[model samples]
Target: MEDLLRPIYQERASDRDTLGILLIEKTRPNSPLTDDFDVILLIIVEDNEDQPWHVKHYEFDDKTAALHVVTEELLMQWIDTSSYRRAVEWVIYGKVIFDRNEYISDLKEQLRSFPSVKRDLRKAIEFGKLVKSYSEAKDLYETLHFKDAYSRMINSLHYLARLAVIEKGFHPEVTVWQQVRYIDPEVYKLYEELTESNEDIEKRVQLMILAIDFVISTRARYSAKHLLDTMGEREGSWSYSELKTHPYLLSYGLDLTAIVSYLAEKNIIKTERVETKGVGVYQRKYLVTDKE
Candidate 1:
């Protein structure tokens, strides 16, 4: 492997005359020789099966100038095709490693896993673009629950997103969810609810309808438990603080204390804490007395 790669290393190190001949002679196995070492290396990476497919041209260049010159075209090809998978795996494995106090070992693992995801992602994006040409992916539900018929369409969008990540070297796992929230918060919320409930298609659809109605009617001011109760009855009352403590509230980001402060500031619902002489101070759940 080293001997096969030695020529490429030597070509860059040797003068333009000798380097040019060797690169050209090497291309006799193929066709269309040119002055560009860039073309030569590309062919080598693509056509040379004995060498690893994912090897970057810069591995030969230890200096900044040579590395930058050699990588100008090849880098873009890799970025366009393979970067997403590399970035994502880096984030996932990096996070897991740092969490375990084994950062060094994890870093080495990242170096290895990084290339596979890139190669896969590039292929995925190409596959996605081909699929997107024939179908449409207009919304979150289509991309999520109805992935069967629109699999290609969804894949295309995912691949495109991955491609962007690869180009930018960004890895935000919440990014996809944040995109859903922006595009369709109601639909996103419904998806979260249904996923948590583990309901079937019919149940999920029905729940989605209720969630839409909930978002439209009440401004999403109630806790999950209160939301369920309100859906069941169309009207109910409870104290703000007590609603926060409800067991189901974990499904949302709200905790008991934060819920009270938020509801009071928003004025979405009225609050009351009932103090009974024998029972002591008991906080009731918040009730939606009015809707604006």
Candidate 2:
């Protein structure tokens, strides 16, 4: 496969702006890692204002190839925010075919280290999604939608499992449950109870709802550290819009309402009502609690 991909990456390497190139071969049939393509050619280039990435499908000497033209800036954003989950996989598993000043090599080392700031951001984002989905699941259960609640609970658990893995200072891998099974068997057991238990859908959903609530509360302060820290940076309380739109928080893509509500419910944060245009009305704002 390298024989076929050599000239392609060579052509890119010839460009002055091209920083590095990596080749990720599909390890097995029907694998989604490379989108089932025979191979993936990841060409990293210097930042450009035009766009973040340009993707192309090619038939290189009859072997299917997926070309990803990504800029250094966008790649960094993806790594920081976990915007594109596969970005980590690419950097971790890719075979470095070309390197300019060992950029790709250093990046791999950085990811292996998994700095606390990046991990905290990923945790906060995952926790927000967990709270949102878990809340929806409970609402569904209240409405007697057992099957729907079960499916939502599955998603919620997936987020929780990822959260557990992140808290342990590891990136969630393709087979996250496999990682969770070893990292935190307790969460893996929750997954098993939800999926493998012989109980009817309603009972299983009920059981998970209670368990996940406790888990969320347990991790609330820790998982919300990034957001709480950001809010604490400024003196006054932050309106929901301000908190959600802040540049630092933007990367997390937070489900702001859900996170804020859960934090208030668990007393991790406090909410205040400020006077609005209407004399008797008020707008809600959130702040880090004094003790937090």
Candidate 3:
């Protein structure tokens, strides 16, 4: 049974020119000859789900007549498995990773392309909209909607949310990774290196958000000293002690020094030394360069 099955899969793997569905029918393991063509499987690349779940089948058939006749552009309908249901759920729930309203609105457009599923797709869309609204309204790390929607969809949604967390620079937690894996295990395997514990993830999220805010707020004024100083308050000038209190500086405590050095090296700022009489103290004052 393994010998016959392995060769067929290998043949399928090698045939890049033949794109579409591969129908494979195999006989029973116990009686390979009598049940020779008893099992049949339909393998089609699912456009909706990611690459791995692309293959789906329905019934089991084993017979010389049932060997998968392969080619591209041909779509396999189904065999015995709930591949269709899984595909539908993935599309509905995966939208949570992206903008929910926008995704559904586009889905409405995609459904129009396939006239057959358009009607059922619309009904799914109506329910999907409701689910999305609820998911978005909840606070970050606050709401967990795992049970309400279809299991496959919830799985996709959870993976998407964790991806958002990763993009925001906070590490995803093991539990978050688990949630994503429950939907698409492949994603977990792909991004396993970045995800961390919840506490670490929270800190990363805060840092990411803060960095973005800092960049936006400092666009007009391109000085690190100014960027660091003005991030928290409206005051014009802050003492060195008062400046250290800013979270912006604390976030990159070590890099902050290097950034200042870089600015000086670039001649963006002029650094001067002043000597105080008796105290013999040196102070550096920064002035914006003409190039800035």
Best by TM-score: 2
Off by over 4 Å in 2: 60-62
Please provide, for model 1 over 1-292, each residue's C-alpha lDDT reduced to its tens digit, 9 standing for 90 to 100: 2344456545544433111111212233332232223222222111223333343443333321011122223433434344333323322332121122343345345544455434333333333342232233324344454544233333434433333333333432325556555554544554466456666654554444444334322422322224334323446665544444554343232233433444455565565666667567765556566652
Error of 2 at 85 (Å): 1.6
RMSD (Cα, Å) of candidate 2? Answer: 1.4
RMSD of each: 19.1, 1.4, 21.6
Considering summed lDDT, which 10 consecutive residues are worst modelled in model 3? 74-83
Tens-place lDDT per residue, model 3, 112-156, is 343422222222222223223323322242334323222333343
Q: Candidate 2 — what's its lDDT? A: 0.89
lDDT, model 2, position 153: 99
lDDT at 38 for candidate 2? 90
Quick one: ranking by lDDT, best first?
A: 2, 1, 3
RMSD of 1: 19.1
Best lDDT among the predictions, by candidate number: 2
Model 3 misplacement above 4 A: 1-243, 277-279
